[model samples]
Target: MLNLNDLRFFVQAVDCGGFTAAGRRLGAPKTTVSKRVAELETALGARLIHRTSRSFTLTEVGRDFYDHARAALIEAETAEAMVRRRQAEPSGTLRLTASVPTAQLYLADHLPALAEAYPKLHLVVEVTDRFVDLVQEGFDIALRSHFAPLPDSQLLQRPLAREDIVLIAAPAYLEKHGTPQWPQDLAVHAGLLTGPGATTWRLGGGDADEAVEVTPRPRMLADESVVLLKAAAAGLGITCLPEAMCRDELARGAVVRVLPGWTAGSVTTTLLMPHRRGQLPAVRAVVDFLCARLAR
Candidate 1:
């Protein structure tokens, strides 16, 4: 059980040739330096120094210990420097988790720029619809979109974007089933839904908010928004999705917004991290990147 500090003190004393000299160099008392070396000797159960009033000498054991101690101190210092450098610069692997749709549609496109900007950083992204425990899963960060305020948790969250949810369907589906002139007309149409929001479509903005109960049941049900979106794109049914996720599809006429004037509601996109303190440089960099770009 060698104390690293004691080893450092012993090495310094040996290098300086006396406790008094080592103390001056270390900004410590001479007696303190001598005591540390003594404690180090006691811990090793070996006398490391031969002392006289005139000068201090190293025993054979002391010389051997000095060599190893000096090398250890150098290695320890090198490791410290390396970590400090990493802290100053964004480098190393950043583990992030996000919903499948957001990852595929939004994050995928932005990753290239992030890579180019921080060449030292390597990103490992996990895409899943299920909420993951950031601490338990060892994730550096998580990107999540929620309509409601997130449940109380120890993790810190930063709002990245307020994403609007829009109902969309393929042109063929709209044409065959006939377009819904009002939100209630969605009850008769084949609805592609993800999870609990399957039958309940909340529309409008501000004080004019309205809830339309969908009927005839959902034609397709899936846990992933992307799956429901693909089903809607294939002309199976109408589905609601994030505007950002469907931007490309909408632009290319793959999917058209249903009930254009209405919305399912806006969800807050957030960046979740374990704590504000001691965040790795890479994690901080990615968080900043997403917040800046996504907000735009």
Candidate 2:
């Protein structure tokens, strides 16, 4: 019989890129993880890993087995989530990460309610614009906005909110440079762009996605969404930002929307967590709280 725990260790080893890394994630000694893998391979009479002094690579047979092992783990996790769903309450430490603005605007306002509802739940929030390694960073959940879908299946994602990227500028800048009527006019105007994916922004209407390449003058190139927003508000440059990020500013007339007809769609927020079985009560609680709060 295949030991599921050993299979999990194998998957972790592959994901973390080494036996020592897998051991750290599983909180086991490196030798223990190594021995369990060796034992599993011996029982099956097959070589699963192509090991070297510096690295480990999977063989064809190892890849095949990994697929099955990964599926089994996902199913087990789903089952455990079902069980946690039946319980009326949640408790424990919930480590979470999010962009600085989202944390300030959404989570900071909402997480207290969740914590209050579940007194035993302790919430730790890490706010940053940079990508975080969830497992390595010891985070239970992360909230992010991306133009593209997260490409990894090893992390389960739950969509929290649907948002749109709207062109924003101070009334002064629009008056000075004249507002851009179409995507093409953006080339002539001073603009701000978010950096993460590629530097290109997809701008268009309906189902036909149009890619427009713009070279914006950078007083400073901001990697952080909040900083980008502040620059736009100060009338430094026009920017396309998530609607959620600029809601308060738009409402207050600090920044006004431009190019209503020609808009870009790059706004999506999701809760991401490690694809694991038997998440404890506190983790599940934080997930539910975030889903509900963001949904609203």
lDDT of each: 0.81, 0.77
Model 1: residues with Cα > 4 Å off, grouped in runs: 1-88, 195-197, 205-209, 276-279
* True lDDT of residue 79, candidate 2: 65
TM-score of each: 0.66, 0.66
Model 2 Cα RMSD, 1 decimal: 5.1
Q: Output the worst ten-in-a-row residue range by lDDT, candidate 2.
A: 211-220
User: Number of clashes in model 2?
Assistant: 0
lDDT of 2 by residue, 1-296 (tens): 88888888888887788899889878999998898888889888999999999879999999999888877876776666567657745655568899877687668888778878888667788898788988656677888866688787678888888788888998888887788776767767776766644345567673445666555554446677888899899888788887888989999999998877656776677788886622655676677777777777
lDDT of 1 by residue, 1-296 (tens): 68999998998898778999889878999999999998888899999999889979999989998878866775675566469665666777778899876687658879899999888888888998887888545577888878899987888888888878998999999999999887778888988877755567767743454555445357888877778778989999888888988888999999999888888888787888876322555666788888788877
Q: Scored by Cα lDDT, where does model 2 land? A: 0.77
CA RMSD per model (angstroms):
14.5, 5.1
Q: What TM-score quantifies how close candidate 2 is to the native fold? A: 0.66
Error of 2 at 44 (Å): 3.8
